[model samples]
Target: MTHPELVIRKAVWKGEEVDLLVADGKILDVIPSSDTMYEGAEVVAAKGLLLMPSMTDVHTHLREPGFEYKEDIASGLKAAVHGGFSNIMCMANTDPVNDNAVVTDEMLRKAKAAYPEGGPRLFPIGALTKGLEGKELAPMHEMAEAGCAAFSNDGLPVKNSELFRRAMEYGSDTGKPIIDHCEDPYLAPAVGVNEGEVSSVLGLAGQPDVAEAAQVARDLLMAEYLDMHIHLAHISCRKSVDLIAWAKKRGVKVTAETCPHYLLLTEDALNGYSSDTKVNPPLRTADDVDALLAGIKDGTIDMFATDHAPHAAHEKEVEFMHAPCGISGLDSALSLTWSLVASGKITFDDFIRMWTTAPCETFDLPLNSFKKGDPADFFLFDPSEEWVLDATTMHSKGKNTPFRGQTLKGRVISHFLSGKKIV
Candidate 1:
């Protein structure tokens, strides 16, 4: 079937109105809107909408193969597109755990079936430890061959330093970075909140910043010794940022990412004992938030990831201490990040680079630019659109979000991937 030429008219590109012509699954041209003439093409009037390359998330949890109640490949991808993301890398923390080539192949097959004609491509991260048990190393070589984008033991950190080193060394050979969920279980066993005044007032067990910083410190040293690429996932504490900055100065092959919650919200969000605020590497103090912002400014933090963990509503409705540590983020990542941009904390270009360019560079994925011959992957965003985040309106099955009733500015109006409109 020959697809009609897709023409987006009057879209704002770099502060000027432009027309985008997409055909044959590529961007044919980008010309001044006034100079373009529409003929028999499919027209989309995008007046007053901002046009840019869609974003990518390097850390996400699309619970498939074991935990479909929370999220699946199809639902997760739908949520990603709704948030203006064109590519995502899912963590390997499923029921059986994605630890080998078999699981990796199965995920790729399912992803293809979910988006058959190339919509927001899904990349699976194979587990570094078998079953994420932190004992035996997973089949990295075979999984890599089967199309694993990276290796990570995300939900559970590998506590054994020797085992972790071996995994890092092996991962380096695959040319993919070893992403670690930096945490010391011994230091903060089953804790739900950050160790600080808020935790004390709320009477919840606190997971101190040291829990994450210590592990980050260890991983950085290991990366230095082995000279392998290490990417830290969802860093939340100030000390952790300090450690990563110190590592980069020493020329360690390390890159770190911070989630939107860590940058925008703090442990104070848990003031009312809201389980929705409970997240692994629990939210830290305002001081930590400030440090994280500084990290982004100084280039210590490489990218912004949603860490889009989703859980069932029933699971999060119970007592705060027993509730699972996560919140659905795919639907809110862009708006929340836009809040930062609007506040002048980061420039619009910085936000775009972090979400688009930085992630591609970190994962070695194909960079998307709305250039001629480039894949037609972009989104139309309305920065002034204001709306409340209602869980029922979301595409993801898991609606356990802390921002459920919050009003957010900016929203994705339309998205095209591979010259096809998926949202």
Candidate 2:
């Protein structure tokens, strides 16, 4: 059962009209549309569509090995493909946690079976601390040998600086980034919202900006001292952005990422106590949003990730304080990001670089490109398409999104992974 070669005709690629030829799971050629004539190849007329390298999300939670009611690898991969992402790095917060080689091996086996014919590739991040308890280090050497992309105690931050320094020292030898969820438990309340007008007016326990920026500052200093790479996850405060900029200026091996929700939504979204807006490192003031946008524009922020945490409907249907702190993002990340491009906050090329090239470079994943012999992992996108996001239509099992019912511009019309159309 041999598949025919795929030829995209008259597609707009890198601001020019070109024809793309994909065969044997690799891009064979990319030439001007007017110069090519493929009489027998499977032709796809992509006259007005845009062709760009597919996206890669470095932070996502596919609640498998325990929380399948929320999301599994199969359904999560579906959401990734639908969101125009060809690769995703999953967090190790599942039942039994991916702290050892056995769990990493099991996850890889499951992912391979899920995408047997070619879909989004899954990279598992091993736990930085055993059980994510943040007391002792996990078996990093064993997990790395079994295919873990990085080490993180995500969901919860490592509170002990000495323990984190030890982990960074160990990780420097492996050459993988030590990614941490930056938050000081002492500064953050048990049930926390952003410490500001929203929390004050609503009479809820507030998690101040220092809860995140303090940890970020410590991690950056430790990375500089230890001469190791540290990646910050889901930075949401102005102070955190400023700290990252200062660290980069001083030549520290530090990189940071932010989610789309932090850019598009604000504390205003919580006016009615919406549980969907109850993300960890809760949405901040308009000034913080402006700072994050500036960070993106000035290249202070290295990458953009979804932090695609999914939760069961029952888990998110409760009161804001009782509800789990996360929202399903794999289904809406790209669309929300396009809003930035549409508003001129970031250019189209910059969006592609942040979502695709930057993450791949930072995490040592395969660089997605249109070069000959590169895997045909890309998508045809429509920049002018308008559609309302209905959570019911989402491919993920979780319907916990703050963007439900919002009209968004731009969408992935078709996606190809390994030369096969998956959406």
Candidate 3:
């Protein structure tokens, strides 16, 4: 018998039926009800819901310090918690650009200060190049000492391969990851939409698939050469997925992530040239979509990330080619991922790994699982409940979401962060 602070009976963990007991923000015990007894604790009946380890988004843009018009740290984090995330990593592309130790430190300070009453943990990433200009490397050691969670040059790829290799070497020495936005500017010059029949029909400039694959190839080779950890962000092209799979099989020290948009939407989404579907490493063909989802199933893709880029109304409300690239994905990422699993495309256990375990491992966060002594960072969701996204009422300050009006299967009934209810 154990006297826990709270007990959730009939929780589904790792797809198995179990009772979860929690105390002081950590799981205390899990036992078969027939062999267990609770003395005094608050009970939550979780018969139909899945008790998943807290979700983590390794790719998200908070748009703070300068782009408050789009989103701020507080608003972005609030949206994340409501969406059942317990930990999230913010990208380094910001106002001052989190390239220097000072800017990186400020990002971390503001993120810490913006913690909601009960919300997901925020981890700030530092830039790899000074100002992310790719002309010169930033002070990697200094930013690492300042508590940056990782090093990245997201949103912009380092065009200079030599400089990128130098950054990788520095990152390896410092034990920091180089998260790259892999898109070769040369192969996909002046393109807007994905290179495909859809783009051809719409008369839009095509962003060839080689753009993404070329960068992934270069970075993976660099990572292997340097013996450094490299993480590719928002992979979209079919060849990009195949390249990662090939590198992983060859034992390269590489890891990568793809966004929900890539898995769920295709270049067909860009046929109308709606800015909402516009994203960096722009959405690709249906073949690319199939490959992305296959990568998730086969473990080639490390995890699912939102790549939750947000933009102001004016920035995205204009005509097709003129609109900025991005989509707000934090809230809709998980539900859509779950739907993919529920439809038998992927197993539930595998889905959990992508959303929970894999992400924490990628970012070097504490191993979060539904086990005793682990933090009570969890999301309780009725997997059967239907949900329709509504950006007007979302917690995010930015209202640009591509999944608006889309129906999803699961709903987060409640979320517990540090043993306290948040949603």
Winning candidate number (lDDT): 1
Please identify model 3 stretches exceeding 4 Å from their true place: 34-37, 116-118
Query: Where is model 2 more than 4 Å wrong at Cα?
Result: 1-4, 189-192
Model 3 has an lDDT value of 0.81
- Candidate 3, 224-274: lDDT as tens digits: 887778888878877988889888888898888888888778878775667
Each model's TM-score? 0.96, 0.97, 0.95
lDDT of each: 0.89, 0.88, 0.81
Cα RMSDs of all predictions? 2.1, 2.1, 1.8
- Candidate 2 lDDT, 1-94, residue by residue in tens: 2333989888998789998888898888888887455556788999999997889999999998899999999999999999999988999999
| Range of the 10 consecutive residues with the lowest summed lDDT in candidate 2 | 184-193
Q: Can you give the lDDT of residue 152 in candidate 3?
A: 84
With candidate 2 superimposed using the best TM-score fit, by how many Å does residue 62's alpha carbon deviate from the native?
A: 0.5
> If ranked by lDDT, best first, what sequence of candidates would result?
1, 2, 3
